[model samples]
Target: MTPTHETPTTPPPSGPVASAEDVELLAALGYEQRFDRKVSLWGNFALGFVYLSPLVGVLSLFAVGLSTAGGPSVFWIVLIGLGQLLVALVFGEIVSQFPLAGGLYQWARRLWNGRYAWFTAWTYICCITIGITSTALFSSDFVASLFGGTAQHPGVASTPLQRLLIAVAVTAVCLVCNSFGTRVLALISKIGLAAELIGIVLVGLYLLLFQRRNPVSIFFHGSSASHPGSYFAAFVAASLVGLFLYYGFEACGEIAEEVPNPARSIPKAMQLTVVVGGLAALLAFAGYALAAPDLEAVLTGSDTNPIPAILQSSVGTVGTKLILLVALTSFIAGVMSQQAAASRIVFSFARDEMFPGARIFSRVTSRYRVPRNALLAVNVAPLLIFVFVYFSPDSLVRIAAFQVLAGYAAFQMVVLAALRMRLKGWRPAGAWSLGRYGFAVNVAALVYGVLAMILLAAPTGDPNASFADRWIALIGFLVVSAVGLVYLLTAKPDRKSTAPEGDALEIAQRLRDRAASAASAERSEA
Candidate 1:
């Protein structure tokens, strides 16, 4: 009476056939295993690690954090990390029960309803579709720094053409890696993981040990930027640094079909990703902070991009350039992992035949055992975003800000659904679960998610900023949500979905109905 909508389908058409247990489990949930289970626990961890990419996060956001929050800005990492750890725990429980590919969409659908799931995916797609382009553009400068094709303007921005070409190239390379096979995706993740560890551990240690230019107390008191009247205000303004870094861990479960025993392994992988990623980011941030020759310059508006300066002054030019290469590698790996996550969401949505052109995007190439068309689909979408952002570089910065806001919005939808299910008496039945602590953890994650969203959406910190500039994140959220609403109403895609909604709640109701009917029959016989 669990509403086991058993999908009596042919054998898995792509990838190696799943083990009987895996196959049966997926079938019970209304899907057949279609991806090779090539990822081990470690490989899954690597995917999340590379996607989180401590080096990329710290290098990119350190200056903003430093300038706004001064030395005390470093603690945003700790605060946001702890908050995000709670989120990971909640996700751990959810993914344990529903380790389906497409991660957010799959989890949301089962916990809530099909309509809710469709919107979650729509908002999420908008986020990652632009996220890839922005991330690629961010790493373009590092790419140019090494390759020497970009003309320097001595503190001005790089040419739009330079950034566009390099970003496209980055997208192209990752597309190849992702389209080939699951094994190749895991390998790139592992390689990126190694390089990131060295960037964080080796470089961080050397910077902290050999290039220590400031006292440890710098982080406690902050700098001139946070001096006197500006202490609390400045710290609050720099919250994006931490908010941006703690995400990307969710990418771990997006390829649940490619992972073995994903229910157990993915939850562990997700939690490990948050814990290790947090520590690595803190290490890298502290190293750069203490090693900076002039902390005040970094904390003030003078040193806009302090990472390269700190590296150059602390290490020689050659070492700094080498680290840049490492950063570029991390960015590429991040793109690869992110693209995999995004494409799988499209595949999951399409397989239900609830999306436009579902047949095409859902196609899996037998040779690679991957959604080749979906992979191409995600890439092509980003190119359109690239074209849109090219004319107005300022919009590109706002796009970066909005990406995190959109992702957190989608994340909260899942959290809200899970909390609702728990209230309705559903318990997680997976290889991993929180047992008695599930409710408490779920509530806490919801609180954190809500507060985080408020922080992200509120237009504060910069008094000189215009309403549009300050409210960009909120504006972006509304625009994306509006578009999704229009689509949901117009297309009515949820009507076509075959996956069970309200998950166990629906199953429990069916059981109750069957019990009542049997009791009536017995009484009539008597």
Candidate 2:
């Protein structure tokens, strides 16, 4: 099948492209370095940081965490941060080797086969598509509050229809910001990083130092430890708080072609996102929990969303609005970054002719040196889902609940594939590597993934809850997986494309051959 506009088969004649090593490595991994390599190590870290968007994660889930595990909830960030870092370490090795676009999908295909990759990519596309939709929709509350539509519901829309309209505008703005190029994406990341630092770190510090009503002791033992189900159950019930905070790290590698030294830069960025972002989130949670005027109300779930109240009390009305502004930008950043990552996956699929409209979506426009069609395509589905968003006003939290679990399922698919290859004596051969520690890290990452999935998918044990609320993650995952299966069987897209599929050793061999060929050409030119 022909691409509607040809995807660049070689770097352009009269412009900057990826570094010589980056170009060779990308060639080895079965893609042209079409995107201009503009993302520095800091920019890469910024993308992961903003995409992880600590303020958005902590603020969105803080009340729920407080309600569930009380003071002990803060520790989950540390616990899950450590677990996700293990996953990132394993990812660091794989991405350092392949450094391909589409992150998890590209790694899975190269480590295993195109069929496995097909399902993996399909699952990932669905997960991220749903994931960003929820994010964009969730931002509506902030948007509504800024406009002074309803005082009774401070940070939420007065009606579902109002929310749908607000959310549509947010998604539209994000898409417009995304279309400019990688530089814009990097700039947005930096902006988001600044906003987050202020929103989480600065706000948390002030709250902890000056406005604390309760002592620091509550972080160790909040009042809810003595519930009927016990502290362990409460801890497990509130697991989503930690799961949500550490996610944006893997996004560092999604645009591998856009960074100069992806193999090294991306791993560092992923690790930093988990570590720095984790600490920031912990501080924010602690500050808010300690500063709450009615701590018992938050713990008992009477104050369902206590963040605005906490901010207003401690920082006053103007300060609260300023923080809300920061939170709004963080939300926008999360949606934009997620959309950018998903578009790369879309482009990768289309480049392989694995997507339905490969002819169109595969094209990287010559002007911006980015995948223009694929980026636009990312928002099209989410636009349609606004109808559903209008009906389910709390759709953001609901879908977020499911995607975190589904996200783990997608992440573990690559980890499992890598582990299988490792068992067969294949080792990572990226510019950055885990060395002798690679296999150990891979094993540990898989263990963490499995544990996280179990914890995330476990029932919340609220009998009054609807069946969908209790089992949403499991049900949503099964439905998405089933749909992908039907398409894989019917469409059989993987068989039609000749994209490379092999174990890591085979991939490494391709890298060596490509590097040698590129070097030979340079020597001849010299």
Candidate 3:
């Protein structure tokens, strides 16, 4: 049965009343059906990796490696990794209970009530939309890198018009890919994950077998002058970047309505995705650190294409080509994944009349069973933002990064709030349970997230830092805050839906049965 067909008594308790417009919007978006439960827990986990695009993490690592004020410290990297794990635990708890496409926005509405929820959701939409621009910009840079030089190279057409054109092309391609359907996107993500894994392994093997270096010592002893003064600061900053790397894993929960046995599969997928992706990132960082030549040069290089430089120095010409290919594949895959997640978020918003063009944007294609128009809307907005950034030239990369980090920070806040409410006797029924530790985990993540936001806003010691860094962070926050204000002024409080006592009991029983079945299956397999 479709999600729409299945009567879920667990709706928001206090929000805008469901008017005809809301019902029409939901119906138009294919909300009448739940997703087919064909996705197993493992498949959902794999899908998360595909959604995250491991290649993006590698690229971010390279960027962090080259940053004037960051990198050269494995301690920072490790700290960031832990921070993300904390944040993911918080998200896992909220999403497992309320697995829906609206993501943080939806959770915020249900937990916070009235305008606060609207503002939170609106901020989330804005952040994700900005993130779409960031992904497009990155994909364009990767494409430009293929032409004999880096995107930053003067010879490689750094002109505003050229960059804008590239961004548009990449965004258009992403839109087309996402318009097909979720299953196709999932398949593509799976293929991308495989390629990314192979590429990492290949690079690691070359570094290990040929470069006769002590991996342990390299990890333990190296220091970069560019890294910040305190391990605490480095940890905070690196965690911000690492959190970005792990951003898209929640896509599984966003599409929970479409998945079979979503309450179970979604949470399982989220956990596995983080664990697997985190391990892969750890290995990749270790290999890159061990294989790097002149750590100072790689860290200090002005070029954005530092990964190629590292591979060329360590593995020769053939290795550089392989690394480039891996980068191209990973980048394109990342763009595709971003498009899918962004579309779903927008569709969810439209279903509740949070956006303009609610009629068109929420409509699902009859043939495709996807929100085709909403996908188009999501893709187009970011493409325009990319163009704006590209033409501004000076502000593109930093602005993109600022927007993404800000959005992520906001989402983290919503998750923290939801967990807090749940702890205060507001629990939702689901297959996954945080047990007694949910509150502690949520608090840790909130603390870490707030610190990371502050660090991101602070200026690096480098004199040549872009204005984009400072202004983008400031403006992004203001924009979200402004939206929040509007929500407070215009939104109305309404009754929230709670699971009927009977339905809640039934759900609990079903969850118990499913757990028992899963345990039995595991034992049998063992």
Output the number of the lDDT-best candidate: 2
TM-score of each: 0.92, 0.93, 0.80
In candidate 2, which residue ranges exceed 4 Å CA deviation? 1-13, 149-158, 222-227, 509-526
Write model 3 residue lDDT over 1-526, tens digit each, in one string: 1135223333233422333432432333234442233345655665677656656666655556434333444444456667767777777766655566766665665566534556666666666677667766665555555555532331133356666877777677767876777667676667677777876766766676676343465444334344545544443444444545666677676666556556556776777667677667666666765666555555555544566556666766665666666766666666776676667777766666666666577666644557887777767677667667755776655665566566666667676666557555654446566778877777788887777676666654344666645456666677667766765565532223221111223333454565698799999999
lDDT of candidate 2 over 54-145, digit per residue (tens): 88888778888888888888888999999999999989988999787889888988888888998998888887888788877767666666
Model 2 weakest 10-residue run by lDDT: 1-10
Model 2, position 36, has a per-residue lDDT of 87
Model 2 Cα shift for residue 342 (angstroms): 0.5
lDDT for model 2, please: 0.83
TM-score, predicted candidate 3 vs. hidden true structure: 0.80
- Model 3 error, position 437 (Å): 2.4
Query: How do the candidates rank by TM-score, highest first?
Result: 2, 1, 3
User: Model 1 — which ten-residue stretch has the worst lDDT?
Assistant: 148-157
Candidate 1 has a TM-score of 0.92
Residue-level lDDT of model 1, residues 34-101, one tens digit each, is 78888889999999998888889997788888877777777888898898888888888888777788
Best candidate, TM-score: 2
